[model samples]
Target chain A: MPIDIDISHVARLARLALDDDQLELYRRQLGVILEHAARVQALDTEGVEPTGHPLGFTNAFRDDEVRPSLDREVVLAEAPEERDGYFVVPPALEGP
Target chain B: MSLADLTITEAARGLRERRFSSRELVDAVLERAAQTEAELHAYLTLDHEGARRAADQADEELASGTDRGPLHGIPIALKDNLCTSGVETTCASQILAGYHPPYDATAVRRLREAGAVPVGKTNLDEFAMGSSTENSAYGPTRNPWDPDRVPGGSSGGSAAAVAAGSALGALGSDTGGSIRQPASLCGLVGVKPTYGLVSRYGLVAFASSLDQIGPLARTVEDAIAILEAIAGHDPADATSWAGEVPDFRAELGRGVEGLRIGTVTELSGDGYEPAVSEAVASMVAELEARGARVEEVSLPTFDVALSAYYLIAPAEASANLARFDGVRYGLRVPGATTEEMMARTRAEGFGPEVIRRILLGTYALSAGYYDAFYGQAHRVRTLIARDFARAYERVDVLVSPTSPTVAFPIGERTEDPLAMYLSDICTIPSNLAGHPAISIPIGLDDAGLPIGFQVMAPALAEPLLFRVAAEVERIAGFDARPTGVAP
Candidate 1:
C-alpha cells in the first residue's frame, strides 16, 4: 500500500523542523517503514489484548515520603538560560 | 598477562592478592585506550584523571583493609546513554552534547559502590537507534576484528572497548539488539538481562519498556560478575523488579545436563549466512554431546518481530524523547516563540537517523493512524510473547545466531534504514518478551570475523540463561583476539 504521509504535520507534533528537502526524504523513508509495518494489521488480532508492558505489571507505587533531591544550583546549571532560580524560556505569550 | 589484558575476575583477584595495584591496571587500560582511540573511536570521553583518583582511593581502601567485592578497582566503560554525575553523558546526539546529569544512573551508582572505576563513556548510535555505529554523532566505532568493517551497534563502542582490551568489561543497553549484536561481532559475551532486572532509573529514555542495561565482557564469568553487581530492585525506578538477585557465579559451573535446548527452526534456515548457521549448529551439537536435549521449535510469528519492533520502539521513543525540547537542559536554539525554538533546536540538534525515527514514531502514534500502526504492533507483541510462552513449555531455553550476518562494511547499510533494521532480526523476540538473553562468541566466519550464538530464557531466568551460555562458551572455546591488539 502506498502511504501518503503528512510529513509537516507529524514533524510539528514531534517538535522537529524539517525543511522541504528533508521532508521529501522522510516522506519516502517513513513510507517504506510504514508499508512494512502494515503487515501486522493483516494478522487476525480479534480478541487479542494489546500488551503495553511485557511483564504485565501495572500501577507500581511507592510511599509518599520525602527524599533527597538534586541541588537547585546544580540542576539549574544545565539550563541554557536561567534567572532568579528558575529556567528562562521563550515567551509563553506573544507581545500584545 | 599485561594489566590491560586482565578480565574483571582476574583483575579483582590480582587486586585482592596485592599482585598488581589498581593504578597499574587503570594506567595500562588508559594507555591502551589512547593508542586505540584513533583507529577504534571507541570512547567519547576517557576519564583518565578521574579513573586515576578512583584507583588511588581503591588502593588506599584495600591497604586500609576495607575491601569491596569483585568489581573493586576494576576498570570498565559505560555506554554514553547512562547518566554519570559530574561527567558528560551524551547519547551521541548533539542535542545532549554537553548535558551533565546531576546524578549517576542507578547501574553506574551500583558499579561505583562496588568499586568499579569508570574509565570512560563509550560511543553508540545516536540515542541508541541504529544497528551500526555509523549513526553516532562523534563517529562510528570500527570493528576491532577488521578496522574497515562496522561494529554492530548501537553499543558498538562498548563491545569494541571490551574486545580491544581497553576495559575489562563495559555496560550497554539493549533496546532491540544493541548489546548482543555488537558483542557477537566483536567476539565477546553480551547480556540483555530480564527487563527491569537492572534499574533503568538514569538510562536516557529510549523505548522505556524495551530498553535494558546489561554487560559485555571478555568472559561469561566476567559478564555475570558485572550483572550481579548491577542487577536488583531500585526504588528509584518504578518498573525495577523487586526480587532476589541470584548468585550468577554459583550458577555458572552447573553444566547444561538434561537441559532442553530448542533451536528456532525459522532463524537457522536459509537467509542466514552459511558460516553463522554452521557456527550455531556446531554449538548445538556440542551441547547435545554434553547431554542437552536439542529440539527444533517454531515461532511462526518470528518473521514479523522486526516490523513490530520498528513500530513499537519508535512509538515509545517518540513519547520518551519529547523531553529534549530546549528549555531545561541540552542544546537550545533560541527563537521568537517556544514552538519555533523547540522545532529549530530539535532539527539542528538531532542527526538524520534520529529525526527519521522521530518522524516515524510521531506518525505511528498520531490520531487516525494509531490503531493501524502502534496498536497493531502491540497486538503482534502479544502474539510474539504467546509464541515464546508456548515454546518454553517444551524447551528450557532457545538458541539462534545473534545476528543474521557478520559485521558488514561501515557504510554498507547507512542509506537504507530498513536494511539496517534487519540486523537485529534474531535478537528482537527476547526483548519483546522481556526475557533474558545472552550472546557468546561461537567461532570465526570465513573472513576471520567473529560470529555470536545467542541463548535466551524466560524472564527472571538469568541463571538458566547463564548456565547454558557458559556451556556454549566452553564448547566453542573461542580464544582468538582481534589482530594488532596486544593483551
Candidate 2:
C-alpha cells in the first residue's frame, strides 16, 4: 500500500516544527514504515478485539485520600522558565 | 579474582566474608570506568563522590554486623532513563540536557534500599528510540567486544558497562528488545520481566503499555539477584502487579528435565546469520540432551509482530512524550507566542529519530487514520498474544535467537529505520505478549562477537525463565572475555 500523508500536517498535530528538508525526509520514511505496517490490515480481524493493554487490566482505583507530594521548591526548580513560586510561560494570545 | 571482574553474587559473598570492603570494590570499578571512558563512552554521569560516601556508610554498617542482604554494598550503573534524586537524568537526548530529577524512580529507590550504590548513569538512544546508541546526543557507546561495532541499544550503555566490568550489574528498560538485544551483542544475561512485575513509577516513559524495567548482568545469577531486589507491588504505579514476588535464586538449580521447550518455526529460518542460528540450535541440542523435550512450533503472526510494535509503540510514545514541552522541564526556546515556543522547543530539543517517531505516531493516531493504522495494530497485537497463548499449551517455554546477527558497524543501520527495526524481531513478540524473557550468551561468532540464546516463559513466570537461562549458561559455558580490558 502506498501512503501519501501530509508531513507538515502531522508535524503540526504533533507540535513539532519541521523544515522543508526534514518534512521531505519524514514523508519518505513514514511512507516506507506505513507500507510495512500495512501488512496487518490484510488479516481478517473481524471478531478479534483490540488489546490496548496486554495484561487486561482495567481502571485501577485506590482509597480517596490526600498524600504528600513533592516539595514545591523541588518541583518548581526543574521548570525552564519560572517566576516567584510559579511556572512562567509565553502569553496565551498575542497582543492585538 | 579482581574486584572489577566479580559478579554481583560473588561481590556480595566476598563482602560478607571480609575478603574485600565495599569501598575497595567501588574504587576498583570507578578506576576501571575511568580507564575505559575514553574508548567506551558508556556513562553519562559518574557519581564518584556520592558512590564513595555510600560505600563508606555501607562498610560502617557491615563492620557493625548489619548485613543488608545480597545487593548490599554492590556498585551498579543505571540507564540514564531511570530517575535519580537530585541527579541529572537525561534520556540521552538534548531535549533533557540539563534536567535534574528531584526524586528517584521506584526501581532506583529499591536498589538503594537493598544497599546497592549507583556509581553512574549510562547512555542510551535519544528518548530510547533508536536501535544503535549512536542516536545519543552525548555519543554512541562502543561495543566492548569490538569498538567499531554498535553495542545494540537503546540500553547499549548499560550492557557495555557490565561487559567491560565498569559496574558489577546495571538496570535497563526494554520497550521493544532494548535490554535483550544489547545483552545479546555484548555477552551478558539480560532479563525483561513480565509486564507490571516491576514498577514503572520513575522510568521516563517510552511506551507505557510495552515498556518494562529489567536488569542486565554478566551472569544469570547476577541478573536474578538484581531482579529480586526491584520486583514487587507499588501503589505509585497503578499498573504494577500485586502478586507475590518469588525467590528466583531458589529456582536456579532446577534442571530442565522433562520440560517441554518449543522452538518458533517462524523465527529459526533463512534471514538469520548462520552463527546465530547455529548457536540457538546447539543450545536446543544441549537442552534435549538434558532430558527436555524439544519440539518445533509455529506462530504464524510472528512476522507481523514487528510491524504492529512499530505502530503501537510510537503511538503511545507520542502521548507519553507530550510532557517534554518547553514549559514544565527540559530545554526551552523563546518565541513570541506559546504555540510557536512549543514548536521551536520541540524542534530544537529532539533528535531526528525522535522527531520521526513522533511524526509517525501522530499520523497514526490522527483523526482520519486512527482505525486503519493504530486500531489495526492493536488487533494484530491481540492476535500475536493469542498465538503465544496457544503455543504455550503444548510447551513450557519458547526459545529463539535473541537477535538476527551480532553487533553491526556503528553507522550501518542508522540510515534506514526499517532495517534497524528488524534487529529486534526475535525479542519483540515476548514484550507484545507481556511474558518474561531472558537473553543469555550462548557463544561467540566467527568474528569473536557473542551470540545470545533467548528463553521466554508465561507471564509472571520469571523463576522459570531464570531456571532455563541458568541451564543454558551451564551448557554453553561461555567464558570468553573482551580484549583490551583491565583484568
Candidate 3:
C-alpha cells in the first residue's frame, strides 16, 4: 500500500526549512524509501514485543551524586552567542 | 619498511625494541598523510602539534620504562564523530563549524591513556548518516585501492587513512556497517563490537541503540589491540555493559578448529557481486578444511532488516539531533523567533542526506504513523534478534559477505538515496541484533579491488570472534596491497 506523507508538515515537525527544490526531491526520495519500508507492515509481529534497545538492559541506575562537570566558561565559549555565561537565542514568544 | 605502514602490533614491537622513536613514527605518518591528502582527502583536521607533543611524551615514558600498553606510542586516526577536547571535532557537517568539544569522548580518553598518538580527525557522512563519505560537508574520501571509487563510509576517511598508511589504525563508529563496510572496501579489518561493549558516552549518536565504536586496522591483531584499549564499562554512559572485558589478544591463536560456522542463507547469492560471494565461499571452504563445521542457517527475518533499519535508525536520529538546535555549541542561523532560528539553522547547516532522514524520522514518529512505522520496525527488530538467538544456538558464528557489492564509483549512487542505503544490506543485521561482528579481507575482486568475509558472533563474543578472524586471516594469506594510489 502506498503511504501519503505531508513533507512540508513533517519538515516543520523536524524544525527544518526546506526550499521548493529540496521539498520535491525529498518527497520523491522518501516516498520510495518508505514504500520499501512498507515490508515491515507485512511481518507477523503480533504478540512480539518491541525492542527499544538491542541489549535489552533496562533502568541503568547509578548513584545520584555530584560529579565534576565541564566548566561554564569553557562550555559557554563554544556557543554561537552568549551573555551572562548563558546561551543567547531568539525569544520563545512573539514580540508585543 | 616505512614506519607509517606498520600495524599497531608491529609498531608497538618496534617502539619497545628501540627500532624507531615515537617522534619518528609520528613524523613518518604525518608525511604520508601529507602525500595522500590531495588524492584521498582522508583527514579533516590534523592535530600536528598535539600529536607531536603526545609522541614526545610517549618517548619520554618509554625511556623511563613506563609502558602504557600495546597502543602506547602508536599513531592512529579517529572518525570525526568521536569527540576530542580542544580539537574541532566536526561530524563532517557545517552545523558544527568551529565547534570544539569541551571533553574527550570515553573512547578518545581511553586511547590517550594507552599512549596512542591521534594524528587527526578523519571525515565522515554528516552525523554519520550516509553510507558514503560523500555526504560529508567537507568532501568524499576516495578509495586507496581505486581512487575513482569511494572508501565505503561514514567511516570512509578512517578506512582510507589506514589503507593509505597515513594512520596505522583508526576508530570508527558502526551504527549500521559504517565500520565494517568501509573496512571491506579498503581491504582492512573492521570490528563492530557488541553494542554495549564500548561506551557511547561521547560518540555522536546516529541511533543510540545501534551505534558502537570499533577499530579499523591493517591486521586483525592490531584491531584487537585497539578494541581492548577502548572496551570496558564506563559509568558515564549508563547503558555501558558492566561486565568484564576479556583479553581479546589472547584469543588470536585459538584458531577456528571445532568452531560451528553458519552462513546466513539470506545474506548472499542475490544482490551480492559474484567475486564477493566467491570470496565468502572460499573462506568457508578453508575454515572447513581446517576442521571447522560449516552449515546453512536461515534467518528469514533478515529480509526485512533494511526496511526496519531505515525506520528505527531514523526515528532515533530525529530525537538525537534535536540537541543541535543552534544557540549552543554550533552554527546558528538568525531568524525572527527561536523556532524559526532553529529551522533556518538546520536548513542551512545540514546536507541533503541528513535533512531527508530527519524528515523521514519525523514522519515515522508522527502521531498517527507511529504505530505503523516506528512501532512495527521495533517489532521487526525484536524478530531479528530472536532469529539471531535461535541461529546462535546452532552455530558458534555466522558468515556472510560484508557488503553486497564492492566500493562503487564516487558519483554512481549519489543520485539514488535508496541505492546508497542498499550498500549496507549485509552489515545491518548484526547491528539490529546487537551482536558482535568483524569484517576481514578474504581476497581481491577480478578488478583487484578487495572482497571481505564477515564473521558475526553472539553478544560479548569478542574473543571467539577474533579467533575465527585470525584463522581466516592466516588461511587466506591475502597480502595484496593497493598499488593504484601509490602508497
Candidate 4:
C-alpha cells in the first residue's frame, strides 16, 4: 500500500517550502522509497529493544572547567544578517 | 615518480630521508591538481597558498628536528563537510555558501597537528545525503577511471582527488558508504572506523549515530597512518569512544594467517555483477591460500539493512538538520515573518536530494507515522546489530564486495533514487551496526575500473581491519592507476 503523506503539511513542519513541482516530485519519489522501507515491517520485532546508537554508551561528562569559546564577532560575521553583536532576524510575530 | 603520486608511506620515507622537501611535494600535488581538476571536478576549494605555507613550515620544523610524526608535510584532502576553521567549509550546499566555521573539526585538527598539508576541501552530496556525488549542489565529480562514470559519492570528490594523484590521501565521512563506496569505485583504500572511534565534533551531522571520519588513500598502510592520527577520544563530541585506540599500524603487518573470515551470504551471490562476484571469490581464494579459514555466514537481517537505513538515517537527519535555519550562518531568503523566512531559505538553499531526505525524515517522525516508520526502523537496527554479534561470534571478520557494480556512467541512476540507494546495499549493514570496515581495491574489473573488496570487523576492531586489509593489499598487488594520468 502506498503511504498517504500530506507533503505540504510535512514540508511546513520541516520548515521547508516546497513548490508545486517539488511537492509532486517528492510525493512520488518518497512513496517508492517508503514502499521499499515497508519491508522492515515484515519481521516480528516484538519485545526487541531499539538501538539509538551503535555503541550503547551515555553521558560522557567533561570536567566543569571553562574553555575558550569562539569569538562572538567572528561567529556573528558569518551570520546572514547581524546587528550590533547579535544575529538579526525577521520578527517572531506578524506586524499589526 | 612524481612527488604527487607518492603514497603517504613513500612520501613520509622520502621526507625523512631528505629525498624531497615538503615544498616540492606540495607543488607537485598542486600542479597535478591544476592538470586534472577541470576534468574531474574533485576539489571544491583548493588551498594552494595554505598548502604551501604548511609544507614550508613542515620543512622548517623537520630541519629543526621538530617532527610531528608520519603525516608531517603530506598533502591530504578533506571532504567539504569536515569543518576547517577560517575556511569556507561548504557541504556543497548553497545554504552554506558564505559560511566559514569558527572551529576545526576534531579530525581535521588532529591531521593539522600531525603537520599534514591541507590541499583543499573536496566536494560531496549536499549535507552528505546522497549515494552519488551528483547530489552535490555544485556538480558531480567524475571518476578518474572513466570521465563518463561517477566517482561514487557522497565522498566522490575526495575519492577522485586521491585516485587522480591530486592528493596523497583524503579524509571522508561515511554515513552509509560515502567513504567506502567511493573508495571502491575510485580504486583506493577507504575506511569507516567504528562509529565513535573518531570524533564527530567538527563534521556536519548527517546521521550522528552512523557518521564516522576515516581515510581514503592509495595504500592500506597510508590509510592506517591517517586513521591512527585521527582516531581517539574527544571531549567535545560526547559520542567519541573513551577507550584506548590500539596502534593499528603496529598490528597491520601481522598478516591474516589463521584468521576466521566469513563471507556474508546476504551481501553476495545473484544480485552482484559477475566481475564483482569474481573479485569477492578471488579475495576468498587468496585469503584461504594464506591459511585464513573462509566460510559463508548467514546474516538474514542484512536483507532488511537497506530498508532500515533509509528510514532511520533520514529520521535522524531530519532532527539534526533543523539547525540550518536562516537566522544564523548560511543563506537567508527574506520574508515577512521568521517562519516564512526559514522556510523560504531552506527551499531555495538545499538541493533536491537534501530536500527529499528532510521531507522523508519529517514524515517518518511525524505524530501518526512515528511508531510505524521511525520506531520500527530502530528495532530493525537492533536486529541488524544482533545479526552482526552472532556472525562475529563465529568469525573474526566478514568479507564482501564493497559495491554491486563498478563505477557506473554519470546520469545513469540520478533519476532513480531507489537504484541509487541500492548501490549502498552491501556497505549499509556495517554502518547500521556501527562496526569498523575498510575497502581495499583487489583488482580492476574487465572494464579496467577498480573493484573494491570489503572487510568488516566488530566495533573498535580497527586493528583487525588493518591486518586483513594489509594482507589483501599484499596479495592483490593492485597498482593500476587511471588511464590518462601519468605519474
Candidate 5:
C-alpha cells in the first residue's frame, strides 16, 4: 500500500471535505486496509475462476404472482413526511 | 410478566397451556421494545397496535386448537430487508425509507402463517453493505451488551433485540456474514441456511446469488425450531430447492460423537486475538473429547476470497439497485425530464454508502474492466468452491472463528470502508463456497465481548452443522456479555 493518496481526487468523487487531521486519519486507516487487500492479491488464483456468488446457481427468479397486497392507505400511513397520498420529497433542483 | 426474559419458545408453550394469551406476550414485548428502543436505537419502527391485533388473533386460534406450529404465538422481529406487507422494509437506507413491500417476503409470509407475530422491523447497515450497523442511514443499532459498542451487522438490530430480550426469535439474512457476525457480537445462535434452504423472494437484494434468509435465536433449539417452520421449497423462488426439509431440532444432539469436524488452519491462527483463539481452541478440544475427529484442513483461497467477494457483491449490487430509480414503488422525485428525475432521485434517496458501492460496482463492471475484475472474480469464486468441496470430502464439517475478534467500539472502523469490509474475512469464504454455517457463542474476550465459533459444512449439511454447533455451545456454556441495563 502506498503512503501517498490523491486526496483531492477522492474528495471530488465522494463530495467530501477533508482537513489535515481528517486526511491524515483516513490515510493511515486506508493504508492498513489496502495493505490487507494487497496480501489477498498475492494468492494463487491462477486456475481458480473468480466466484460470482457462493451459490453457483444463476438466473434465479420469483414466480409471477398477484399476492395479497398491502393496503395503500395503511402503508402510506408510516411515511414520515407524506402528503396528497404520496411521499413528499425535498427539492431536487436548487432555485436560481 | 417480565418482558425482557421471555423466549419465544417459552411464550408459545405458555400461550398453548392457557397460562397467558398471545396479546399479553405482545404487550410485554412491546413494553420491552419501548424500553430498549430509546437507548439502543435497535428498531426503526414498532407496530405495537399491529402486534397486539395479530397476537389477539393468535390467542383466538390457539383457543380453537388451530395451533400453527412451533412458532405459534411467538413474537419475532425481521431484519429490515425482509419485506413484510403493510410494514416498512427500509433495508436501513433512505432510498427505501418509506418503502413497504406490496406483499410479504416468502419467509415473512411463512412465519406469519406459522402464527409468529411480527413485532417490528429492526435496523441494519444500509442495503446490508457494512459489517457494523453504523452505516445505517437512520443510526447505529447499539450493542445490547455494551451500549458504547456495535452489534455487528447488517442484522445487528435483530441480534440486539434478541440479546436485549425484546423478542424471542428473529429472522436475519446472511450475505458475507451479516447474520453470524451480528449474532456473535450480540451472543446468540445465528444460522445461515444453505443457499436454497430458504427462499429469498422478498429480501431486498444486496447480492442475489449469495443472499440467504435464516433464523437468529438465543438457543440452537429455538433456531432449529424456527428453521423447521420456514425452510421449504417455494414455487415463487426459482432458486428455492426441492429437497425435503429435515427436522433440524430432532437431529440436534444426535451424536456428533463420530462427526468429522474440520478446523480451518487459516482461521484458527495468530491472526485471532489470543482470547478469541483460545475460546475456539477450547471448542475444538471439546469436540475431540466428545468423540469427534477434529482435523486440520486448508482453504488457501480464503486469503483472497474477501477481495473477490467485495468485487462480486458490489458489482451485483449496482445492477440489483438499479430498480430504485424513483419511478416504480419507492420515493421518487419529480423532475422536468426523465433522466434528471432518475439522477436526482438516486442522489437524494441513496445514502452515502449505497452510492459509494454503486459507483464502485459500476466501475468494476464497466466494459473495459469487466474481464479484468468481475470476470476474474467469478473464476476465482469457482476455485474457492472447489477448495471447500475437496476439504468436505475428508471432513464432515468445518470450524473457525465467526469473526477475527470480538465487537469493537461503535465508531472504530466507520471512517474507513475498506477496513470495515475486511472484517468479513472469516465469513466471506463460506458465502463464496456456497455452504451452510452457524455462529454460536463460545467464549468471552477481556472486555467481556462474546466470542463466536462458526461451524460450516458442505451444501445441504445444515443437519451436521447443527449437530456440531449445538455440542460446542453445550460445552462452552454462555460467555456473558455485560448487559449494563436490566429488563
Candidate 6:
C-alpha cells in the first residue's frame, strides 16, 4: 500500500514546528520507515494465530481495596500548580 | 569497596560476612553515580539519601541476623517507568515529568523486600518508545565504552548505569528487545524473563502484552540473582505466571554438557558485521567444545518476524499510550476545547519518535486497516510463535546474535529510523514468542565495542537460559569491567 506522506503530514501528525529543511529531512527519514514497514506487511500468516506474547499469563486481579493515600501535602509538593490539594486543571478555555 | 565489578551475589556475600557495611557500598555506588551522572547521563534521579537510609537499615537488620536474600542492601537503579512510591517515576517523557505514584510497582516492592536499595531511576526512551536513549526527555545516556556512542535503548539508561559501574544492577523493561538489545550494545548481561516471569504491575505501559520487567547486570549471575528477587506471581498483574520462579544462579556451572543447543540458521546469515558473525561463531565453537551439541535449526517464519513486530508493537503501543492524553496525573495542556487540549498536550509532551509510533500504530489498528495491518500481523505472530514452539521441541535452547551489529555512533541511524529498527532483528522473535532470552557480552568489534551473545529458551525456561549464558560468559571471558578498566 502506498502512503501519501510528505513532510507536512509528518509535521502536523508529529506536532513539530519544522522548517523547510527539517521537513525534507524528516520526509526522507519517515519514508524509509514506512517503506520498511511495507516490507513487514508482505509476510504470509494464513492460519496462524497472532501471538501478542510468547508466554500467556491471564490477567491477575486484586480486589479493589481503598488504601491510605500519600500525604496530600507531600504529594502536592512537586506540583507546578495545585488548588485545594487537588491537581489544578488548565482553564477549560484559552484566554481571550 | 568496588562493588561496581562484583556480581550481586558476590556483593551480598561480602555484606553478609560483615566485610563492608551496606552504607559503605551504597556510598561508593552513590559517589560513582554522582560523578558520572553528568557525563554518562545514565540516571533520571539520584536517591543518595534515600538509598543511604535503606542501606543503614539493612546493616542494622543484618547485624541482627536478618538476610533479605541477594538484593538486600544492594544499590540498584531502574528505568523511571517502573513506579516507586515516594520516588519520582517519569517515563522519560515530558508528559509525566514529575509524576510520582502512590504505590510501588510490584517489581520495586519485591526488590525493596529483598533489601535492594534503589539509588535512583535510570533514563530511557520516552515511554520506552525509541531504540536509542536519544529520545529520553532528560538526556541521552552515553555508552561507557565510547562516550560518543549511544547506550542502545529503550532501556539505555539501565544499560549505561551498569556499564559505567554507576550501580550494582538495574531493572529494565523490554518490549521488542528493549532489555537484550540495550544490554548487548552496552556490554551488560540482560534477560527479559518469559512474559509473566516478573510482575509488570507498576511498569508504565508500552505494549501491555509485550512489556516485561527484568534485570540488567554486569554478569549472568548478577542478572539471575536479581531475577530471583523479583520473579513471582503478583495479584496486581493478572498475567502473572503461576509456576515457581527457579533459582537461576543454582542452574549455573553445568557447563552446557549434553545440552541441546539450536542455532538460528538464518540469524547468523547476512546483514551482520563480519566481527559480530565471527564472535557468534567463536562463541558457538566454545559451547560445542564444552561438550554441548550445537546444531543449526530453522524458524522459517523468522524472516518475517520483524515485519510482524513493527505492526504488532506499534499497534499495541498506540492503544496503550492513549491513556496519556492530558489526564489527571500527568502534565495537562490548557486549550479552548478538550480536542485542542488533547492535541496540544500530546504534541508538546511526546518526543518525535513517540508521535510517529502512536500514529503508525493507531493507523494500523484504525478502521479500514485493521485486517490488512494489525489483523494480518497478529496472524503472523502466531506463525512466529508456532515456529519457536516447534524449534524448541528440536532444541533445548536457541542461540543467536543479540544484535546484528555493535554499538554505532550517537546519531548514526536516527536519521534513518528503519536502519535503526533493523538492529533488533535477531532479538525480536524472542519477544514475539514470549520466551526467556539473555544477552551477555561475548567480545568486541575491531572498534573495541561490545558484541553480545544471545541465548533464548522456551517459555519460563530461565534455568536453561542461565546455564547457556553463564557457560558462554565463562569461556568467552566476558567480564563486566568497563572497557578501559583493565588498566
Model 1 docking category: high
lDDT of 3 by residue, B14-119 (tens): 9999999999999999999888889999999999999999999999999999999999999989999999999998899999988899999999999999999999
Q: Candidate 4 residues B1-487, lDDT tens each?
A: 6788889999999999999999999999999999998888999999988999999999999999998998999999999999999889989999999788999999999999999999999989888887779998888899999999999989999999999999999999999999999999999999999989999999999999899999999999899889889999998999999989877866767778889999988997776999999988987998999899999999999989999999989989999989998888999999988999999999999988889999999999999999998899999999989999999899999999999999998999989999999999999998999999999999987889999999999988888888999999999999989983443
RMSD to truth, every model? 1.1, 1.0, 1.0, 1.1, 4.4, 3.1
Over the true interface residues, superposed, what is the Cα RMSD of model 4? 0.8
Estimate the TM-score for candidate 2.
0.99
- lDDT (Cα, tens digit) per residue for candidate 2, span B231-300: 9999999999987877686677888999999999989777799999988998899899999999999999
TM-score to native of every candidate shown: 0.98, 0.99, 0.99, 0.99, 0.88, 0.92
lDDT of each: 0.92, 0.92, 0.92, 0.92, 0.79, 0.81
What is the CAPRI rating of model 2's predicted complex? high
Model 1: DockQ score: 0.87
* Chain A accuracy as TM-score for every candidate: 0.94, 0.93, 0.92, 0.92, 0.62, 0.62
Q: Write out the backbone clash pairs for model 2.
A: none
| Fnat per model, in the order shown | 0.88, 0.85, 0.94, 0.93, 0.29, 0.45
Candidate 2 lDDT at B226 equals 91
DockQ of all models, two decimals each:
0.87, 0.87, 0.90, 0.89, 0.22, 0.37
Candidate 5 lDDT over residue span A7-93, tens digit each: 444433332334557546555554453344344445556766555435655565666878975676775655544787886555656
Candidate 1 C-alpha lDDT tens digits along B348-389: 999999899888999999999999999999999999999999
- The candidate, 1 or 3, that scores higher on DockQ is 3
| lDDT minimum window of 10 residues, candidate 3 chain A | A1-10
